[model samples]
Target: MIKVFYIEDNNGQYISADGSKRWTRLTGQALYDFLQTERGKKTHFFVDTDDNGVAIGVEIRNTELASNLKGDKNHSDYLKQVRDESGYITVSFDYFETEDGTSTGDEVIPNDEDSIENDVLRQFDLETLRRALDTLTEDEHALICALFLQDKPMTEREYAKSIGVPRTTLEHRKKLVLQKLIKFF
Candidate 1:
């Protein structure tokens, strides 16, 4: 006996239970896999028989039936190679944090002054860096802030262009500022 699969009133389309996409794709792998699933097993398939009403073969609903509507006439069409559509295919990946993703006692970055008390050396170095930064000229200070301290710091080229300065000139000034800062260390 031969069986052909199809939904009663669908436009030859059977979507996945998630409704994110149509499960009746032309590729056989997905359809084959779906058939192996519980939902796929529950799908309705019709009998396709010879003129004598004798059984020939079985056609799965989400696979052969969908392929038929796609104009794939050859019975061996599923045997042909299919281009991978994994990029466009959407699969839900909302898994909870597994043991592999968990962090193991790493130092967390401090968010405020009180949090910095956890490390005395870091606190001292930060105070020294603040004093060094205070000695910068207004122009140099603005450049430093734009390049390094902003929440979304600008690139050197971008900051230079914004201040109407050549990149090389900005680099030279930055170098001089670093040299000045080194003296304060």
Candidate 2:
């Protein structure tokens, strides 16, 4: 028997943004592990079965599912190899602290007033930002992380060309990402 896993809240209440039920099937366990560990959430996994009560696949709902929906050609073929070599697929989810150590409300403020520029940047909670970011598509997250979360940043044109998109499209995407981040603030 095969099982399908769908992610629900820690309490197992699964609902979409419109207050409707959402469901989908998970193909590969590697894909499942990528989402659970990378996103750091408690997922409610549901096993799927045939009419004969034989396990089949897992049901899932999230941006991760959407991103991998068509299944990349290489990745899909690779998963097939993995499934052939292994007898079973396994996946699990867990929750962990977003930050290391404890944060005290009494951290010292910098005396350099120039260091603080955007008011929105100053007021964001780390956990809230993380949650908001998780709402973004995988591509958007990857682009933003590549640009802002690196020591050396890629030029907009260079990054755009690398992704096979127009420079203007990249700029527009960056703007949208900034707007989403601002909403969290």
Residue-wise lDDT of candidate 1 within 62-144, one digit each (tens)?
A: 76674664454343333332324333432233343357866433334336765556578787888998999999999988888
**1-185, model 2: which lDDT tens digit per residue?**
44445543444455667766654434468445745684425442333346887555333446476446435645766786898899755332222222664544333434555466544455556678788889899998988887887688888888899999999999999999989888877
Report per-prediction Cα RMSD to one decimal: 17.2, 23.5
TM-score of each: 0.38, 0.33
lDDT of each: 0.64, 0.64
Question: In model 2, what is the error at residue 103, expressed in angstroms?
Answer: 33
Model 1 alpha-carbon drift over 4 Å, by segment:
1-118
